[model samples]
Target: MQTDSKTIYTPFVRAKDSVWEVMSDVLLALIPCAVISYFAYGEAPLFVMFVAVISAMVGEFIFAGIFLKKWNTLLDGSAIVTAILLAFTLAPFTPWYVVAFGSAMAVIFGKILWGGLGRNMFNPALVGREFMTVFFPLVMTSRTIWYNKDYVNFQDLNIFNFLGNGGFTEYMNSIFFKPSGAIGEYSVLLLVLGGLYLLLRRRISWHIPFGLLVTFFILLQIFAFKDIKFSLGGILLGTLFMATDMPSSASTKMGKLYYGAMIGLVAMLCLLNDVKYEYMSYSILLVNGFVIPINWVFKPKVWGENINLKERVGAGVLLTIGIVATTYALVYLHHFDLVRYLIFAYILIVIGRFSFSKQLH
Candidate 1:
């Protein structure tokens, strides 16, 4: 009976295959982006991609050899995924060394230093992007985002020369569909297909992705994302590339939902304020950094998990008590002005999901 039970549950935990599944899935998803990059920025995208991917793979192998004292994950394709992902986020004209530096930081500091693969606190791609932001701000921010600008950020290191000479609309269109950059990110259509594949493959859960999409689109439509006319694509991009991080995101369904909502909330605020810096990558990394602590403390009750009415009331009471305490403290600190939304979010989150239906047997 125990063995049977174990067999039944194993698929839920591990999926049908091993780590290579993820590596290949990510690579397959990246193909659209690569094709688009080739045409838009010409050969520069390919060249930069090659450098970035190779650097990331080599970095991973070296780090594993040094840190693990063995060859685990060296050829597992995770590094290739990381490399391609990092490169995908970059502009076509970025410098080769910049890619190498970012790749190294991603594999070594972001991943390997934390005992590798499943143990890191944030996404490796996010780490590389953030490292690029801090260490080489010019290149990351200077490269035009495939369109809307004619020139690279004067501060960039210029990894590829061809991106400097593309037509604006042509480049923009390439970003939308034509094979252009990295392996898979350039074409939005292909990204969606790949995302669907992962969903069906059960490689990731929908809770966080749905949470991210609904919250982001609603908030963006409500506040700042109005320019896009209620498009859920941005959040989709985040879900596929950023927030689905198995290690950093919440582990339980409820936990992942809450985590995704929090990220969406913070990112909406950022987008609303017109954060002139790198938008998607920066927001994703920030959320990734915050998820570690949130998950540690916010485990949710299991389905069929019992909740005593008395204990539930006690929790509500505790929350009320804490709010009251906070109100008093804020009063003393002259920060009471921030309490207006306190009641609103609490009421909605706690009260809105309730249906008042008959309890099912």
Candidate 2:
């Protein structure tokens, strides 16, 4: 009855050129954002790109071979995709050090530590984004990469000032690429073009990106339509191309839609609640974490196990107790922070609940 937890039997190996196809598509997908950032932000955007790609690939190779004891499939291109996507989410003009740090997070911490390549539970890009946000809150939240057109043509002065204490309003006219966050990410146009190229190439499914973009646009129109930086095109460019490409995310049609919709909805909520960081990279990662089980469960299953009446009633009662306790705590504490500790505990009960309703694999 017992089977190996780590065993992964696949009908198809990911294909030899599949890696290249995916990587190339991702690159093309990222192009629009890159170009947009370049036109708006300036030269610094490119540096972040370099840092992200180089560091992530290098990390992937090291972990895949020495750490994970695997062969040189660096050509597979997943690492490259992760790196580029990480770059796309960051502000274009961040300190090279910030990008360097994020690259390490995406590489060593994000993908490698989680078992490398396909086994990862969270989106590597969001790992990088979250790492930056948590450690360097001041730098990450300052909108440093957001370029202002007023400083356009005066590249040096504007770039430096933007580096220092530039105002988001001061550079409204410069548009997406002038010099905003995470190097190439500022240019919605460049990013969108890249996304289109990827779709054309069939590197990734349209479901995730399309779902994310469509949901986010609906949210953006109501919440951020008037905001200069958070317009329709820009939000679509970032979420559709950048966040949704995260490999660890859901792959099934229904799973992808729900996953992306959660991301879009949470991002809108984060914005509405005045939380910073565009597109909710961390939130995307969070949703991706929960989507793995969803995908597995959504797959057609062979029946084996059946629930007993006693177990069913017990589960229902415990779930009710858990829900009531959570509710009362939330209402009493006036905040959800009190329940953060309950999540892991709830994970087990939730798993038990789902397991009770399903047949064994």
Best by lDDT: 1
- Per-residue lDDT of model 1, residues 17-122, tens digit only: 7788776776776676566556555677787778877888888888678756667676667788777777777767678888788888787766776667776666
Give one digit per residue, the lDDT tens place, for model 2 in 66-93. 7567767578777777777777776656
Runs in model 2 deviating more than 4 A are 1-16, 71-73, 143-182, 219-234, 301-361
Give the per-residue Cα lDDT of candidate 2 at 244: 61
Window of ten residues with lowest summed lDDT in model 2: 4-13
- Per-candidate TM equals 0.69, 0.67
lDDT of 2 at 45: 64
Candidate lDDT (C-alpha), each = 0.60, 0.58
Q: Which prediction has the highest TM-score against the true structure? A: 1
| Candidate 1 local Cα displacement, residue 103, angstroms | 0.9
Worst 10-residue lDDT window for candidate 1 reads 1-10
